[model samples]
Target: MSTVGRPPGRGTDEPVGDLVSRASQQISALVREEMRLARAEMTQKGKRFGMGGGLFGGAGLIGFLAAQASAAAVIAALALLLPVWASALITAALLAAVAAAMAAAGRRQVAEAGTPAPQQAIDSVKADVTEIKEATHR
Candidate 1:
C-alpha cells in the first residue's frame, strides 16, 4: 500500500505538514521562553537601580540635615564677631549659593544617566529576529 519512492508519511503516521506545524509550534514556544527570560533580567536590573537611587536619596537627606546644623553653628560663631542678624544673613546666603551649585550638579548627573531600558535584551532579540528571517528566506 506504500508508495515506491515517497515515504509512507503521506499515508501513515504523522504527515510532513504535521511535522512542519509541530516545528513552528516549538519555535513559538522557544521565542516565548526567551521573552520571559529577557523580562526577568530587566526586572532584576530595575530593582537594583531603584534601590541604589533610593539609598542615594536617603544619604542626601541626611547630609542636608547635617549641613543645616553645621550652618547654624557657623552663624553662632560669626555672631560673636558681628551683629546676630548680619551673621545669620551672611551664613544663609553662603549656604543658599552652595546648595544651588550642588543642585545643578546633581541635575546634570541625573540627566546624563539616560533611560534604563534593557538594551542587551533588545539587541539579542533583534539578532534572533535577523537569524529567523535569514533561515526563513533560505
Candidate 2:
C-alpha cells in the first residue's frame, strides 16, 4: 500500500516498517518525558525534606536548651535548702540514675530484637524452592 503524499491518519495505509519506527520513537519520547517528570518531582520532594529536616534539627537544639534550663532550675531549687555543691551533686546523681535506667532499657530492647537478618523471608524462599523441587520430581 502506498502512503506517499497522504497526511498521517488512522485509515491511511502505511508500511509496517514505518509504523514500527514511529511506535518506537513515540515510546522513547514517552519514556524520556516520564523520566523528566520523575526527576522534577524527586527534586521538589528532596528540597522539602531537607527543609523539614533542618527545622527538626533547630527544634531539637531548642529542646536541648530547655532541658538544660530545667535541670538548672532543679539545682537552684535544691540549693535553697542545701549547700550549692551538695545540690549539684544530688542533681548529678539523679541524672546518672536516670541515664543508667534508660541504658538498661535500651539494652533489653536490643536483645529482644534478636538478629537483623530477614528470617521470615528466607524461610519463605526456602519453602518455595522445596515446593518447586517437589513439583519437578512429580
Winning candidate number (lDDT)? 2
Query: lDDT (0-100) at residue 43 of candidate 2?
Result: 100
TM-score, every prediction: 0.54, 0.84
Give per-candidate clash totals.
0, 0
lDDT of 2 by residue, 63-84 (tens): 9999899889999999999998
Model 1 poorest ten-residue lDDT run:
6-15
Where model 1 places Cα greater than 4 Å from the true spot, the runs are 1-14, 96-138
| Native RMSD of candidate 1 (Å) | 12.0
Cα lDDT, all candidates: 0.92, 0.94
Candidate 2 least-lDDT 10 residues:
5-14
Model 2 bad stretches (over 4 Å): 1-11, 130-138
* Model 2 alpha-carbon miss at residue 36, Å: 0.7
Q: What does candidate 2 score on TM? A: 0.84
